[model samples]
Target: MSLPDMRFRAEQHLRRQLDFQHVRTHGRRHDCGAFMLWYARQAAPIAPVAAVPAASTDAVSPDGATPAETAPRSRSHQKKSASGPIPARVGVVASKSAVGNAVQRARAKRRLREAFRQHQLRVPAGYDLLLVARSSLNRLEYREIERRFADACLKIFPAAKA
Candidate 1:
């Protein structure tokens, strides 16, 4: 049987410097054997847009005014509402002080990313997560690393609410 697409997309990652700083400053942290997990619940999902009728040229405003009479919504507001909820994002930090040379650091990141990608569905939505690698991470096998990550996620996010 063909497995489902599980590729990690850029949108799924915690990319912004501000996001990282926010998590660092305010998120709760959990220490697994090989790494530290930092997480925080994000804001509520955006309100879904109302469906527009294809045949209607003139849309009625919510306040009982014509479309032209109503003030146009800002572009940023439209974009924010269109994009919907931000999914659980993950950021991996493998510093030189913890994970040795560049190659090792990259390897650690790759392994962590893979583990997160495979088990991301189990993790609850709407959390910003940061995983900081430790020196001991290099010694563990990939399976062990994945197991550690899964355990950490379970501890950090106990019940996966629908």
Candidate 2:
């Protein structure tokens, strides 16, 4: 049975080679023993607010000289404003050289993804995470893997919300 909290949304998935490369290039790294974690916070997306045209220039008077042109500016337009924080995204990597044969690599990645999915909320918003599996990953118990992931979360995001 799939739990809502454990449902890995598409938005929360890190796809595309560029994104993977970006996280590896600029993100901070943490060694979880069985895996290496790399994470970087992304900037939130901002929606631009349309500006209202300054009260139409005092309509042309008979003289044609607009009063607005003559009057000292009394007010300025308010600054444009509006505020996706893209949901936290995670990617798993289990290379042949790192995690062994195909079956082992797949298992390692699956475990890592499942672990991240279950406690993803513990991670703050707008972060890109990469979990690279090691050969040791397959040898570890699921509970131990989960615990290490939790500890890694704490060390990486010390102020993470409960």
Candidate 3:
């Protein structure tokens, strides 16, 4: 299949400067802690990194309302999907078991891409994103995958003042 042209359309499009391969390489076989250190040491640190905000989770609200105190929260965390500045790139790692067949794997990937496309607003510009799909994706709902993807992005790129 032809890969999408993830090129930067405008100067602000992160697709121009993002290094999807680099993010994946740094994250290979490593956890978030290790990844964070690797980022600090690397010459080309992932640009425009933002830590996932606590508010993004089901925690205290900006107004200090507990989950019980407020109306049911929207599934914002599960909604985050893509990461990058210009042509924001998304990485995928599917388990060999769940999506055992080539067709299933492709389907899973398509769903992931759709998730990314739907949540472009949450992702900031000019950043590289790596997505590691858990084996359970075959069983998990699409929204769950989306949420986890966003959380992972936030973990990798915390929202500090730019």
Whole-model lDDT per candidate: 0.77, 0.79, 0.46
lDDT of candidate 3 over 34-121, digit per residue (tens)? 1111121122433343434455456886798665566544432122335532434454544556456777677676666665565544
Per-residue lDDT of model 2, residues 52-99, tens digit only = 445566566567767555554422111122332456789999999988
Better candidate number, 1 or 3, judged by TM-score: 1
**On lDDT, who's better, 1 or 2?**
2
lDDT of 1 by residue, 1-162 (tens): 977557787767877677788789888998887998888875333555544443455766678776545544433311232465556779999999989999999999988888889888667767888989999888999999898888888766779631
Worst 10-residue stretch by lDDT in candidate 2?
74-83
Worst 10 residues of 3 by lDDT: 34-43
TM-score of 2: 0.71
Q: Candidate 2 lDDT (Cα, whole model)?
A: 0.79
C-alpha RMSD values across all candidates: 8.3, 11.8, 19.6
C-alpha TM-scores of all predictions? 0.71, 0.71, 0.44
Off by over 4 Å in 1: 1-5, 43-84
